[model samples]
Each structure stands twice: as structure tokens, then as C-alpha cells.
Target: MKYNNPVIKGFHPDPSVCKVGEDFYLVTSSFEYFPGIPIFHSRDLVNWEQIGHVLTRESQLPLKRVHSYTTSQGIYAPTIRHHDGRFYVIAMNVSNHKTFYVWSDQPNGPWSEPIIVEGLAGFDPSLFFDKDGKVYLTAGAFPGFGPEGIIQAELDIESGQLITESKFIWKGTGGSSPEGPHLYKINDWYYLLVAEGGTEYGHMVTVARSKNPYGPFESNPHNPILSNRSTKLPIQATGHADIVQACDGSWWSVFLGFRPVKSTKVHHLGRETNLAPVEWSEDNWPIIGNNGRAEIQHNGKSLPLGEPIPWQGKEEFDDESLTSVWNFYRNPQKGSWSLTIKQGSLTLYGQSSTLNDYESPAFVGRRQQHFNCEISTLMEFSPKEEGEEAGLTVFMNENHHYEVAKTMKQGKSIILFRRCVGSLWKVENETEYDESIVVFTIKATETDFTFSYTKTNGELEVIGSGETSLLSTQVAGGFTGLYFGLYATGNGKVSTSPAHFEYFHYLPGDE
Candidate 1:
């Protein structure tokens, strides 16, 4: 069987995986997006289903005023591991400077409240369970301006405390930004894997091993066991990997990589999860892919293919609660939005006036999974004030976004096309429409985004178009992907009324 790369697509970066019985569970970084660390399940390594989020409640993962800094300064990398009949997820909150762990009996369920790991420094924390009932924690430590190296410490899982002094381990294969470290005990040696050369075109995965868990480690002679840097492959920046052995005794790896359109360098969908086969050499060293490069198609003896679970398309907003696909900008304020307040509609009370501010507005969105897709929503908003606006937005970050909103101007309802890149704001297009209800739409292709709307005349009219490259990480300079969803704001003043969205439909190219 041949499986495609990027088993999970769109902005889900820093993938970590662990297997239990016949089930394989995975997690990825969410960075400033509320309900962080999306949890996924798969019987075969190819097909994945998002079961739930690891950080669901504000208490478990707080994002208070996170947008005040930058969109990339929230949750960094999360590592999920299953041990002793319990599942554990450990992650770092860069904005809040906290390292915490949450556990549950099952992957999708009532996860335990966060237990802050005191005295642990650095980012990209991972857990390694030894065979003798001992657990260890490792991460990248930056004590100075030099190479950020890997660190190790014994962790008392029951109390979430360090039982020993932290030790600095290998600094990787001398690549820049050596981070995302994971430890594995194979045979009689402990192998440490780390992603180096940053998370861009130079990204690579390197490994080291030692007989003792904390000792003089040796770097792999054939270093950078996995990478696609400087190659013409469509998938680039391949690193930040986690390995797991299947129930059938086969080794596989899931890592983060981005797919730029052929002959182009811009990729707006961000880092996604890609899987590749791991072949162990005679010396017991793991070789990833052929010649250390991942491929779009992998052929091997894999778990049987199964039907894919449906996700993110045509939401009617009639459910009692927001579905797992919808995520807020930051930690949403209590009662800021509700579905039951207006039956069959999602009512979003406007908070902030603009999207560029460091405030969490009434916004609910899902990741833009594909470059070519159509997203639209029917919004009914009657702004009594001048700055109140509500409609659809393609958001990259607080400083970068495009919105097609209905705002009040000169005591009349007007549809406006606003684009904000950095500190610049351009109202590229606007038209006066007397209709109170409108359907806002955005047709996005690989390189462009077309904005349109339907008013009282019941005809779709094009408003404005923008280059999709403006939303790419290369242009926007963020670690997140694009989010297309509903947004309402008062520009700073409180909105007299809320914006109600009847439905949100996202049709991918294949669909």
C-alpha cells in the first residue's frame, strides 16, 4: 500500500506520537489558538481523525492577553505519551513562561487539570518512560547565545517535580536552532533525536545516542537522518519528528513539513504532519526515507486502509455547543459568544473594534486546510454604532488578515473589504447595501483570494481580490497557518447588538 505524505494537513505543526495497543495517538502545536494541542487518533498510521483538544478549558490552558505580544508566542511544542494505562501531554506556554502536564485515562475525555512542572526551563518538552518504571523529561535549553542544546532531568510523574539536577546533553549536529528533542530507549542504548537548523528551509532532524540516560552522548556519523533542505521537493522544512512502533512491529515517524506549490516558495497552509517509513540499519541506527528525504508517496506493509472521519465542512451552527473544529482566537471570554442564545444561529457579541489589536475579539474559526477552497457565512448584523462590524475574515495573525465585513457608515449598511498587513490598513473596496442580512464569501486559490457577497438582490457580487501569498508565513512572519471564519468587533466600543451567523460552509477543492 502507498500512503500520501502529510497525513494531517494545515497548520498542525510539531507533531508528537505514541502508540498503545492497536491505536496510535498524535498531537500538534496550536500557538495562540484557544483549545490548543489538537489530539488525533489512528488505527493505521496513514488515516488520522481529530478526536479532541488536549487543552480544552481556560484552567487547563490559559491564553490571557497572549495576543498582546505576538501570534507566535503561545504554546510551543507538545509531546503526548501513553504510560501506565494513562495518557500524558506536556507542553510549554511561552507567553506565560509555564511548563505543565495534563493526563487522562483516555485520549478524548475529561483531561486532568494542568500540573505545573516547577524548575523546568526551556521549550519543546518531551517525556521518555524507561523500562524500570522511571520517567525522564528532556528539552532544548538556551543558557546563552550559542547553540541551544538538549537537557535532561528525572521527573516524578506523580508529583510533577524534578527529582534530579538538569544536565545539558548533546548540542545536535551543529545546526542552527537545535530544538524539539525526544528520547527513546532501544535495545540497550538511549537514542536522542533533535530538530536543528531552525524550522525553515534549513530544518533537519539529527540524532545522538548513549548507553547511559545521562552521559557522554555520541552524534550520529551519518547525521541529519531526515531532511529535505536545499532539495526541489514540494515538501520543505522537514523536521520536529516523533517516532512510534506499530502493533505489527514496524517503525514509522510523523514530522512537521510544509507543501509549497510547485515552482513556488509560498505556503500559506503552514507546517503539517507528514509520515515516512523508518528503516533500521545493521548498526541499529534508524534511516528515515531514501537518502534522508521524505516522499509524497510511501509504499510498504502498513495497517489496512480505513474510511476517513469527516471534518470541517458546512457548519450550520445548530448544535448546542461549538464543534471541535471551531477554535477561538485566544482564550475566549466567558459568555462572549453563544449558540443557544439564538437558536440555529451563533451570536457573537462584538468586543474589539479592529482585528490588528492585541485583544481577543468575538471570533471562531477553523484552519484553512487547502489552498483552493470556498468559505462563506450568512451573517445578520445591525450595527447601531459606527465601528461595529461583523462578517468573514481570513486571518493569519493580529497584524495580518483580510476581512469582508458589514459595517455602518454614514447611517447606512455597507459591505467593506479590509486588508491589514503589518501596520497598514487598506479598505480596498466597499459598497452601500441596504440589506441587513448578507452572505459573505471568499474564494481562495493557491495564489489569490476573491471576496464576494450576496445582498438583498440575491446575486453574488465580487468585492475585492488579494494575493494569497500575503498570508504566507514568509510574508506574514508567523508560525501559524491561515484561519477562515466568522468575526465581529466594535473597534473598541461595546457593540449594542450581537452578530448572528446562520451557517458557515467550507468546501475544499475535491469536495
Candidate 2:
């Protein structure tokens, strides 16, 4: 059964897959986002379900300096494996610059405490156990110039520590930044797979092999076994891959890729997860595409005809807590946000007044999913002080954010479209309002954003719509995704004005 490109959609990237007896489990990178390393269970390698998250507790992760411009923190690419009744996952938490491993007898685990591996200085670390029962760790390290390449060393299986000396493997093909290395053995050769060409438009996967586990290896003549180079397939970044062989011996690869929306002139879906089949050549080298580069289109390979699971773009707060779809930019203070099922609404408490403030609290948001999606929120904002503000925002970083806010101007409450350009927050547009409860909706189409609002009025009307590229990756120099959050701020004293979020609805297409 041929499957679509993104086997798992929305913000899941840097995929690693493992198979055990008919069961397949997949894990992906969770940069800066809490509850790091999402784990999924699949039977056919095509259809997948999220079973759990690996780093759910604060002690398992170090979150300081998490919301910086780089926004790089928490866990990176994670490698999952099942051996001797123990399911193990090893990953690096860049915030503390350490590699850690967690193990459990079951795939859905009561996982053990993290075993930290010291002296490692790079990202995207992976562990591989050979047939001889020797555990080897491979990772990508920067030599200060650019993305250096892959390094391999023996790791003590019991202690989760490095044993043998580290050795350099492939330094890339002289043109790309080689990272995300995965090691495997087929026949007598140990294969090292590396991603190069950066994670942007030129992203690709290359393979090299050696007779010995630590080697002088040869590059695959069919290098770049998979890529989306030919068409610039809207989804620009498409490398950082991991491979798994299904129980039936069919080969499949899970990797990271993304699609950019013109309206946001930025990516909202984040780095999505993609799946493709691999075919081996007569020479034992892997060839991914029938034509040349990897294709996103499904070719009806091996999938069930069951109806697609309907997904929701909107969320109701008729629950005790937030759902998995709602995630904070960094580690959240539990008491800061809540939803009372009986009250049937979300409450965000006032904290800091500005987005630049580290404690600028009162924030609950969802990942911007589609390029042309519509998001509307029912909100009641009551601000107390002069600089106190509360509203809805499309947040990129501390410095890059756009908001539609209800502010207490003079004695009256007014709605304004505010933006943080460079370092200043400016009121670019505003409308005088008298309503106590308001409904605000932001329609993002192709790189354009339109702000609209409604009171007791029949329907909302657009306040202003303009071309804005508020959603950028770490390139715009922040590690945060474009978030739709309800925020409240105060000048010095905490604002007594409470904000109620009735509901948040995000529709991918106009419905």
C-alpha cells in the first residue's frame, strides 16, 4: 500500500523508526516544545497513532534559555529501539548540552530516569546495537566552520556512556552540512546514512558503507537515496531521515519535510513528518524514487482502504485541561492556565505586560497549522492598568509578533492591531469598541492576514488585512512557531482583569 508523503502530519520531524515483531514505533524531534520526542505506534509503517511522549517531566529536560532567538532547547532527534524486552530511546537535550537515554520494558513505558551521557558536544545523537551485541553511538558535530559531519564510537549499553574513542566518518560530499546520522548493517557492511545540503531547499539523504563497523567507508554511487530537489515541491526542507524494515521485509523511511504558505510567507505546519518506500539496487545500495527525487504523491503501495480519521482544527475548553493539540512555547507553569469543564471556558491569568518579558504570562496557544487557515476566538478581556493589555496574537518570538488586542484607552476599551517591528510595539490600526465580550478571528490566506471582530453583532467584519510574513523559522532567528495565543499583560502590578477564552477554532480551509 503506497502511502502519502507526510505519514504523520504537523510539526513532527526528524523521524526515527523501529520495528519489533509486527509492531512499528516512530519517534521525532521536539525542538524547544515541551513533552519532547513524540512516540507513535504503527502496524503497517503507513498508518500511525501517537502512543505517548518521552520527555513529559521537567526533570527529564532542562528548559532554561528556551525561548531565545535560536529557540533551540529541549530534545533533538531521538533514536528508538527495542532489544531484550527493553525499549530504549536516546536523544540530546541541547539546552544542557547532554545526551540522555530512557528505557522501559514496554514501548508504552513507565520509563526510567534519564541516564546522562557527558562530554558530547553535538546534536542529533543516535545509538545502534550491532549483531554482535556491541552498542555504537553516532552523532553529528560542528567543527566550527560549518556542519562538520558524522562521528561514531562504541557506547556502553549498560551505563549509556561512551567507551571507545570517537572516530570521524563521512564529512559530507563537500557541499552540504551532514547531520542526523543513522547506522545499520546489511550483509557484511555497516551503513551510515547522513543528511546533507542543509535542511532547506537543497536537503538530501546520502549513504556510505564500510566492511567494519568503524570504517573507511565508500559512498553510495546512488547517493541521496531520497530528496525533493527536482520540483521545489513547496515543502522545501526534506532530509533528516531514519529507516526501518517492516516485518514483511519491505523497506520504509521516515523523515522531516515542510510546506510553506505564501500568505504567512512563513511556515506554520512546522517541519512535518514524511514517509517513503526504499528499494535496494543490485549492488545493495538504496534507491528511493522511481523517477529521481522522492515524491510526495501516494502511489497505492500498501495501505488499507479504511476511511481517513477525521481531524479537528478547532478546540473547545469543556475539559479539565488543555489537549495535546495545544502546546506552550516553553515549559509552562501549571497554575498559569486552566479550563473549567463546568464553566465551559478557558481562563488565562494576567502576568507580564510585554511579549519581550520572559514572564509575559497568560498565554495559551495552538500551532499555526495551514497556510490558508482561519482562527477565531471568543474572548472577554478586562484590563486594569494603563499599559495592561490582553488579546489574541500570532506570535513568532519576543521581538517578532502581531496581535489584535483589546486595550483600555482613556476610559473606553478599544481594539487595535498591534505589531512588534524590530524592537517597538506600534499600534498600526484600531477600532473603537463598546462591547465587553468580543469574538476575534484571523484569516490567514497565502501570506496575508486579516483581522476581524464581532460583538453582539450578527457577524464579524474585517478590521484590517495585510501582507505579513510573521511566521519564520529560526531563520527569522527564533526557535518558536507561529502561535495563536490569548495573552494578558500588566505594567507592574498584576492586572486584576481576567481574560476568558470561550473557544478557539482553527479551520484549515474555509468551512
- Compose the digit string of candidate 2's lDDT tens values, residues 1-511: 4556666766777889888887889888776666667788877766677777777777886566643445456777888988887889999877767788998888777688899887665568888888888998888875683448888888888887788777777776754678899899987889898888887767889889999877888988767787776564655667888888766667777888877664323565578887777788888988665533656665646533244446666677887867666655566655556676238788776665456655435677766756678888888776656666678888766677788888777777788887775566677888777677899889887667888888777567777765545446743454335667777776554666777888888888731
Q: How do the residues 38-106 of candidate 1 rate in per-residue lDDT, one tens digit apiece?
A: 999999988898888999998887776533545686788999999989999999987688999999998
Off by over 4 Å in 1: 66-69, 143-147
Cα TM-score of candidate 1:
0.97
Clash totals, every prediction: 4, 12
lDDT of all predictions = 0.87, 0.74
